[model samples]
Target: MTQSKEIKKPSSGLAARIFRQQMFIPLAALFLLALFNFIMDPSFYRISFDYNSVGNPVLSGNIISILDAGSELAILAIGMTLVTAATGGQDISVGAAIAISGSVVLRVLCGTNSRPDTLQAPIFVAILVSCVVAMLFGAFNGMLVAYFRIQPMVATLILFTAGRSIAAWINNNELPIISDPSFGVFGGFIPGIPIPTPIFIAAGCMIVIALVLRFTNLGLYVQSVGINESSSRLNGLNPAFIKFLTFVVLGLCVAVAGLIKVSRFSSINYSVVAKDIEMDAILAVALGGNALSGGKFNMKASIIGAYVIQFLATTLYKFKVQSTALPAYKAVVVILLVVLSAPKVREYLARIGKQIRQKTHVKEAG
Candidate 1:
């Protein structure tokens, strides 16, 4: 009986530890969703190799497709994670910002001609200029929020309303189609690579950010500012500078996402490019077990959350759900996940755990 009780204690403790993990909730949801998909169709997660129109090898399947599609959101989520960590606020203008950047890329490419065949000197210039434009836009939001002490949502709302129009104006209200084949490599696949290039781009961004966070004091400083700006300042950290820097990083991410979006179709539609992505980016951050109120963050969890969102959307469409109705269904699931990850729910679970342990101890003693 004593041996049995000891064994049960270890198992219970292990279960409790697993449940306490920050990534546990999102991981569990992803697992359950994957299971559901498998049950619905045994081949849902299967991957296969195929040749593209250009005779290049490519990975094709639902699972690979989901990851490929989620790349843009995943990249945006990393920036959103940093911004949320430093400012305790989410950016509502990321979608608009993406539009502006995408337009900049095309506007520069189309300079001197509507469609250029070869990758000219102008493409590189366009990429640089677009990234700068995005950074400036981000700085504007930072100034409003940090310098003027405006709320992030309200501050970014200005760009949210006019960013698309600004993008349209940049391109003279023309939807430019890029005629370069090499440009598609960023969004599609390279000759020797079977996986999508956006996956590599997203992975590279994550790696760079991960290394920065791991090797430097930026992570600590950002968390300090987010947790308490006064305390951060008193500790000799520049809270305002940290906040501004975070927005700039987000702007860079916006440029990358925009470039990928344009490369995907080799075209830009100012009206619909990157529409409503801010919602997905915020949802990814929240579902990743990070607090919306700010402070500490986990980038890996957020990336997983992004993929989960894409998977959910893909699954919904597989079930014959209409495009318009997809948002409603996804929202319902997101709300439930967010509520389950709430601090109150976690505290209650902790309380119940203690009670259960106490009951088990009493039983063993008796």
Candidate 2:
């Protein structure tokens, strides 16, 4: 069973050339950010010793804050990546999911009506309940996007419309105080690393998802359906079921993001929480180089994009600039990055380019 094979290389490889040219934009952006930050604040680069000197393991320093914030984004991005790549859909409801899912956690575990003595239950109960409810929300999204054949964009719209409103309704539109000591653990830093607990959870989630997508049969099925559902179906794949599974996963992700939001705020908000979160996931997936039309999946790239977006925001905040303008600026930057990272259009253009070159050569020799 030991067969030797030669490594193959295409004669006309343009990928190397193109990737080099395209990398300039992201590179330049990072360079400029570093330059700007370095010129202004010398202390910005000083890594804090807060991680080791912390009393509460979670809220030690900026390192964990960034990770805590990233957990919400990371959770959302994983689902968004799945939706966009494997399920052939997108959801604007995740922002709503953040609110709805977290509201469920707060209300179920620490509702105002609960006996004051039992308001603070073990954190595990709230965590488990939040995850289950989140899956339900994701399943709801799957029913629309996968089973009904509704446009993925429109299908998740149902959640987009009323998800946050309902989340707000649960808490009477005010932030509910969570009194659970165990659940409160999530808001603190780890003993060693300055990283927040939420970040560790998010990192764990990323690892799990990445493993699932790589080793299991689900991975093959996902790429198959995303590449060509018709072909995969002819080959005995259940495209509908696979797609449904993915949306359910998406729901779980939204729920996780909502959980992170809750942990970050230590409460629940219906009116203001998780507003416009779908955009963050979309940007992360897009920037990660995942195809908009669906094909290869890049979980690592998506994580990087999430970090980049967060850092961009951090940079702006550290400079005392009006943060309100960030959304628009980030969007513009992302759109351009998407345009540059796009592989398909460039392939098509390259094909046409070859044809024209052949024709021109023929005319010159003729």
Compare the candidates by TM-score and give the number of the best one: 1
Could you tell me every candidate's TM-score relative to the true structure?
A: 0.94, 0.81
RMSD for each of the candidates: 2.3, 6.7
Clashes of 2: 9
lDDT of model 1, residue 108: 82
Instruction: Tell me the lDDT of candidate 1.
Output: 0.90
Tens digit of lDDT per residue, candidate 2, span 57-176? 323333345556767787788888777877666777888888888898887776576324456555668778888888888888888777888988898888889887888787676566
Tens digits of per-residue lDDT, candidate 1, 239-275, equal 9999999999999999999999999999988888888
Q: Whose lDDT is greatest here?
A: 1
Candidate 1 regions exceeding 4 Å error are 1-7, 116-120, 352-366
lDDT of 1 at 46: 81
User: Worst lDDT window (10 residues) for model 2?
Assistant: 1-10
Error of 2 at 273 (Å): 1.3
The Cα error of candidate 2 at residue 209, in Å, is 1.3
